[model samples]
Target chain A: MAKNGNDKSRHIIQFIWTLITNAYLIGFIRGKIYQGKIKNICVPGLNCYSCPGAAASCPIGALQAVIGSYEYKFSFYIAGFFIIIGTLMGRFVCGYLCPFGLFQDILNKIPLKIKINTFRFDRALRYLKYIVLIVFVVIMPLLITDIIGQGFPWFCKIICPAGTLEGGLPLVILNDSLKSAVGLLYGWKCFILILLIVFSVIIYRPFCKYVCPLGAIYSLFNPISVFKYQIDKDKCVECKKCASVCKMGCNPTVNPNSLECIRCGKCKSVCPKDAIECVSFNKRKTN
Target chain B: MKNNKSRIITVSMLLIGVLFLSAGILRGENIIIFEKAINICLECIGIG
Candidate 1:
């Protein structure tokens, strides 16, 4: 009961944060900032840096900036920050903090008439994120150098609907000059955004499930991440109820820390025997 | 019984931790290194 209450409270808080970070609010705040050093808060999860309303710096953008900086070295500060957050909370950030994740959650609530069962295909395609993490997020930027031999934001340009919807749209709208300069790349991004918006209405979080390199990176820590779920085999009867309720279709009993498991706690809430519990690495070590 | 449970949990955590650490290290080495960061920065700033 207490766990469920905590989950509900966390969900509410996440929803409120999403509202505050929406394009309207961020744009308003950014409009107020004329000059001085604006302290940009780095929230975990993908938010767009180019969004006219964004008050905080997108971590991905900052990381890319560091990568693409004139200096020929990676910024330890940004990398360390992401590592610390990922190791500590894993995808809990995705479930409890990401504004984009919250947007998907809201879209998921729209009383949709059509639903597709792509569990098998989805399971296979989940590996695609690791490829994306390597190719788009990590490799492409590093390997592709220009005349002066500097990296580019390949992932941001090619993919990332958050960048398109939150960053690209607002900037183009607010600055009429940018509208006139719109090209094939802008159209491509808009197309991707539309596809994602429509897909989100049908699927839970197609991006999070298949495309989010950030999610892929965080998922690497899912097993050993401080915030984790455990299943007591002694109490479990192999009822498969947990699996049935899992939106990610992950079997908690087989692998409680499956990369696909978002640590949403839905399975834990539904378990009859209270076999599942959210455990901390520190707590386990001390015991 | 308690010892057995503890051992299982410890072993599980160790294996998982090693897997994650290895992957992180591999990714850091193979993909995200200093040279790459420099390249990305240059491209974004349009000097590339």
Candidate 2:
């Protein structure tokens, strides 16, 4: 089935609901007022597990725990969860879900609207996210050790605005007695969050483009993702409209599976050539 | 085409390696970093 603009908008709205509810912001508020147990739904994105209001575990955090566990060689649960989600829908998770991605989308809606038309630089910079995935997510925690011998989730500490927004702020507000303990790390996180918010207004999805390790992981499955886009060469006429409307800043013609393409389907909706279609796994041929 | 294909293959290999390696590293120990550090550090400072 073809996607319309309204369908895209609905997806965005649903994404917002998922974010607010899944972040346990709602539960946090409820739990705070009623003294009820905080309930959290473990969604696939990088929502922080430590958010005081959080009812569910962050998938990335869960994965990290499984990895760092001494008794178990690795966490089958976290790995299986990511693999299942990834293999099933791939980066459709980024396009259809992901609160952080939605937040960036909202920020990118600011009407000043100066487009930074730097295609080559954008493509080159997309690789930086992979570097983040490697260095912060993988290497630091495994390699670096303090004198007491504790591993760090370097990515969560150094990056991740979701934690700041969801975990940091709520906890601060709730626990007034805990207010005086501010330090450089909080300042740094606030600085990064502010930077991301400001950049999101100017450049679309600055985090998704440059820093999101989760997006980087999902992008790997783009080539074989079940929810994929197919372009018809026979229908010819490369007007570049698809590329232009793409919020993810990808050329659907050249690299339909681009890590930058969130599969948001703006291109598919606007294609004058009627060239693009969403491909399902069950269907063998592109219609 | 060959160079492009090779580059993609290399990138894919590297990504898979990194994912496994990351999963390995993050299994059990929950050392706070990034935003978690901010939250914890804030809590430590009596802010959060």
Candidate 3:
């Protein structure tokens, strides 16, 4: 009963954080993107830069811009930002802070008969996000250039369902000028967004599992992050309860700091022995 | 010993992050990020 309460609290926290991050009320009302100094700082989640209500920039978008720009090949600021955040909490950002992750969590709550938690090639498909981080977010931007030596943010342009949903839809719907400009590309992105929405209802965070470049980057630091999970094997009875409750499909009994763990705390809540705990920076109990 | 190593890694990574962030700020990378973010990129909205 206490664990279930914690789960409810997690959702409430997710919703509250989402509201705090995208809190430019004037922008939402006027269909304009916030151009404040706050926008200079990139939020840890996958919120879009062009979102009418977004008061902060998306880190992935900022990373691509720096890598793709003619004047700057790379930005130390952005790199440092990722390192600091990734090393501190890792994919806990995905679990608690991401708007898109919240969207998926909400969708997965709907009662569905055919919930596809995992299927064949599920583990293999997890690598696709890293490939996207490399190819679309990193390599393509540096390699391909326009006449003026400017490069495109390929992921934002061709992919990034978050951009399409959070930024594209609102702006286009509110502004008639943007409506006429919308063409086949917009249609394609909308289709992808729709497909993802449907999939989210059936599957648990399919995008985070298979396509989110930000999730990919953070997942790399799950093992070494200052905030991490610790499982006490002495207390554990080797029951598979923790594994079964994990929506991200991580087995905390075998590996407490699995790369796939979003630090959602489901395993911690469900552990019968009270063995799993989220601890900070090498604070393991002596037992 | 494992705990000690983890502490070292965390501190080292944090110092490195601070170093890089300082360097980027000195290079005016924040200005570039600000400029890019203030304007709505056509591509970001899935158009143009």
Best by DockQ: 3
lDDT by residue for model 2 over B1-48, one digit each (tens)? Answer: 543553455456445645754654465222322223223433222233
Question: How do all models score by TM-score?
Answer: 0.78, 0.77, 0.98
| Clashes per model (N, Cα, C within 3 A) | 11, 30, 0
Docking class of 2: incorrect
Write model 1 residue lDDT over A1-287, tens digit each, in one string.
75567467767978777665543464544332111123233557786645555445566666665565445335454555566677678888788878788777777767879965365687889889899878877677677877776677788777878877766665566655566777777777788888988888888888899998888878876866777888777788899888887777788999998888787788888888988888876333222
For model 1, what is the error of residue A175's alpha carbon versus the real structure, in angstroms, after optimal superposition?
2.0
Error of 2 at A217 (Å): 0.6
Q: List model 2 lDDT by residue over A260-282, tens digit each.
A: 77778788878878888777542
Off by over 4 Å in 1: A1-10, A19-26, A29-41, A282-287, B1-48
Any runs in candidate 2 off by more than 4 Å, and if so which? A1-13, A16-27, A30-41, A117-120, A146-149, B1-48
Interface C-alpha root-mean-square deviation, candidates in order: 8.7, 8.6, 1.0
Model 3 clash pairs are none
Which rank order by DockQ, best down to worst?
Answer: 3, 2, 1
Error of 1 at A146 (Å): 2.0
Scoring only the A-chain of each prediction against the true A-chain gives TM-scores of: 0.88, 0.86, 0.98
Compared with the true structure, model 1 gives a TM-score of: 0.78
TM accuracy, model 3: 0.98
